[model samples]
Target: MTQTAPVMRDPGEDGRFGDFGGRFVPEALIPACEELHDAFRDAWTDDAFREEFHHVLREFGGRPTPITYLARLSESLGVRVYAKREDLAHTGSHKINNVVGQTLLTRRMGKTRVIAETGAGQHGVATATAAARLGLDCTVYMGELDTQRQALNVFRMELLGAKVVPVTSGSRTLKDAVNEAMREWVTCVDDTHYCLGSVMGPHPFPWMVREFQSIIGHEASRQMAELGVGTPDVVVACVGGGSNAAGIFAGFADSTAELVGVEAAGGAAISGGQPGVLHGMKSMLLQSESGQIEEAESISAGLDYPGIGPEHAHLAAIGRARYVGMADEPVIEALQLLSSSEGIIPALESAHAVAWIAREAGREIPSGSTVLLNLSGRGDKDVAQVRDILKGRS
Candidate 1:
């Protein structure tokens, strides 16, 4: 499902993505980030590092997930809907792509522990799985609210030998969990690797995570070509921290394809958000005018983030990608539609993109237009919440 492409390597000097992706972290972590920067830069180009990355990706992490043509869904919607099935990846989401890469790099850096923050626990479980496979110590920080909502993922992480810590501060969700993870990384800088789940974060992280995840777009583009769909008319993905969107969009940045990023309307950073610093990067954030971070709410816990990845901010500013916001109701509708029509249950986070595509098909998308959507994760994590919503509706 994938093939090699000409890689675009950016130096990421001082980690600034057009004034959006700078390292605005505490002074205590500067040296750690610098060490990670140098280590990552060296290892990424090393032959041994490449070999190890490739080995784990193919042998253990399950690379080249399928590009499924959702014919029934397409017929119902009156457009060509193709899905790059990240949901079928190991650990049930696109998150494992970055985790496997980072876990290998962590081993190279002589780090013995891995740490991260999770909103819906997909990232947390992915990290935990990598840590368990590599025999490294793992710990994940999650908001108490999310811990309760996604308790099954907590149990999954525990099964994979990771200890989950609940963050109770602020809104008690992804943001607070990230705050706690950063604090942990600063304190345990020598022995720990912070496995960031998205493309948002200080300089090297945005650049590094994107490089790991760009595999999705790389293979997907090749698969599309093989399918005789030379160039898609549009590419759509839902954005929480923008990792999946960045991965898929990075592949078509130079193509004549139009890229669209979907955000949760309740937590719509692109539409009703401002540029500010949150969690060490300057990007579009839901913040107060006086510069305080605001809490975001969404039916989809994974997309309930206040700030987006810095690379996305740059892409938006440069006109490389258009950002769309879909409200909660539409997201639910899309989730139901895809589940019923295609029998493919998408994560609520990804349903935002489906909702956007549904709306676009109703108006803008011409009949028979080819649209590629990143089915970022499976909806197993969302069954309970979805059931609750449906029952309430009944």
Candidate 2:
């Protein structure tokens, strides 16, 4: 048997990251995906397109979000901690960066509407906001259960004039929401663009979304350099579909930073899952013995998925990054801890990374080493859920 050497270079025509990514959609949608791929490629290279994208991001999406030092957390954990505050970005999450870029691409493709799937609701809200700004009609599919849990964001999306559809099939979570979104896109491919919320879908999509979200990593890297820490010992972010983690890791992928992606224990695909296909791309997935896709359970809606982004699977495969899981109990504790320690409340999805860092302070991560964390979103969306959890505990 021969061990396949790590291939970390850009994926070519096959649109793969190792054996994990490619287009696997309905026949009717292949042309749409290809169109999107060609448009993105041209737009990505065109100076005017690049300038417009950056201009929109700076003028509307809020680029270059600041970094904050978690002094109290660093003191308690014995690991110097800094956070790239994507939470402070417009729309209160890193989702805005990807959504802004995708929405711009949507108009470039002459699509009059955008559709998206969201579980935690941040992406849906961001999509709606961007669509409204661009005068494009927006529709967001969310799991029925998630719609109930994240009702506030549902209202926020509607307030931005996007229609919200609740998906009721197959566990009624992020995965099902994605299924619904894809089904909808197949029927309206000509006029609607599926603004995928993560780096989990077919070809072009995984690559495209990552490129949009890469702004986070690029900004953080320069900020770290400006702060006198040219490179940190570790770069950490939570992974569900892995967009935010991929974005932040992109900045440090070639560096000596130990890239760490923390997943909800129930959905720790890279650590506990097998290679399987879901949401159009083959990646590490939580599956049953017969290869049935399993349901992922977590208190955080954003981290509630059965698989990880294909690129993340590749990263883990090539040993370029490490993946770990954190349970719900510690996620709550970490969220509360950060809120109290630094007066900053992190989304439940982001709290998984915080928990892992605290849990691994002296174990996987050496003490006194500088660690950079991507605070992917603010916790306002999760406050009600947390309040209920605390009430139940009491």
Candidate 3:
């Protein structure tokens, strides 16, 4: 495969990446979105705000997560593989990175309360943790199915003093939870800032969330250099709303490394989707001929969404990154392989990347090349579901 450096561009002043992203929300929320955009732009340029945000990350959310070399797994695959250990972050996931940054942004906007939508519940837990620390009211909307599947996370959010509202609309999944959260934001925009969990949604959010989570890629690149390794041959991360993938991609967007985003086979929006609008952004979405969003199914709740971040759509369009899909069986197998071989248990969402490596090794990806995988979160929250899957398989 030819490796060429990609030119990375932030969204235009109108918050568009080519033809993918824009503010396609109700007029009532336009002013709120604009206010957030201005506030974030100003704060992002302020050194004090940057320092404070970095300070909070280091002191609270555990910044500078390590990159593990995964010797045995690499040996098994006949390739050098490194895992960016976002699982070691304080909240056991990369979700906390964006949450902490946005929590600070919420405070800067003088918002007294923050609301969010969650799928696997990691985002809700992170948002709740930040809100509790900052003394802000927090409410998390989660699909009823997700709340049940990730019950412990619901308890964790409540323990952090946040209300967890089970959303019973649509498919009872992430997209539905997002729908409810957007509605809640419309009614409570005055004092309640919607802390969107992923790098989706309207205008500034995709840009702002990427800026916050980009730390993962930045740190991974530095850590790899410290270990005497050059830039990776490829950087891989799973994409649902694409926050983690976008985060890691930001660091290497201008590099020669091939950026690969793995998606759930059952919900592979970019791989099997058409251009359409959903969640306030025009992105690649799994929709029917009539433009109705299709229900996405994936064993990983975090990847069970019909739409992807608009930036991902732009990248794919411009040939800056490659997107692929992995089914549940391989994801589960990859999860177990990492746990058994490297003694690292990865979140199912993260496992999709591993599954891709396994599927492509020595074929699509040549052996001995270096691969950097974003281990987005731990698998503790998925242990029960995986156990059931394993049981049924046996």
Best by lDDT: 3
Candidate 3: C-alpha RMSD to true structure equals 1.3
Candidate 3 lands at a TM-score of 0.98
lDDT of 3 at 340: 99
Put down candidate 2 lDDT per residue, 1-394, tens digits, no spaces: 1224533345777789977898888899999989999998888888998788789888887787999999999999999999999999899999998888899899999999999999978999999999999999999999998899888889999999999999999899889999999999999999999999999898898898898888899999999999998899999999999999999998988788888999999889988899998888999999999999999988888888999999999999888888988999999999999999999999999999999999999888888999999999999988888999999989
* Model 3 alpha-carbon drift over 4 Å, by segment: 1-6
What does candidate 3's lDDT look like per residue over 1-394, in tens digits?
Answer: 4546444456856788778889889899999999999988999999999999899999988888999999998999999999999999988999999989999999999999999999989899999999998999999999998898888999999999999999999888889999999999999999999999888899998999999999999899898899999699999999999999999999888887999999999899998999999889999999998999998889898898999999999899988898998889899999999999999999999999999998898988899999999999999988999999899979
Instruction: TM-score winner between 1 and 3, please give it.
Output: 3
The superposed Cα distance between candidate 2 and the true structure at residue 28, in angstroms, equals: 1.0
Q: Estimate every model's Cα lDDT from 0 to 1.
A: 0.89, 0.91, 0.91
Q: Per-prediction count of colliding residue pairs?
A: 1, 0, 0
Error of 1 at 69 (Å): 0.8
Runs of candidate 1 with Cα error greater than 4 angstroms are 1-11
Off by over 4 Å in 2: 1-9
Could you tell me every candidate's TM-score relative to the true structure? Answer: 0.96, 0.97, 0.98
Backbone clash pairs for candidate 2 read none
lDDT of 3 at 22: 92
Report how far off residue 101 is in candidate 3 (Å): 0.6
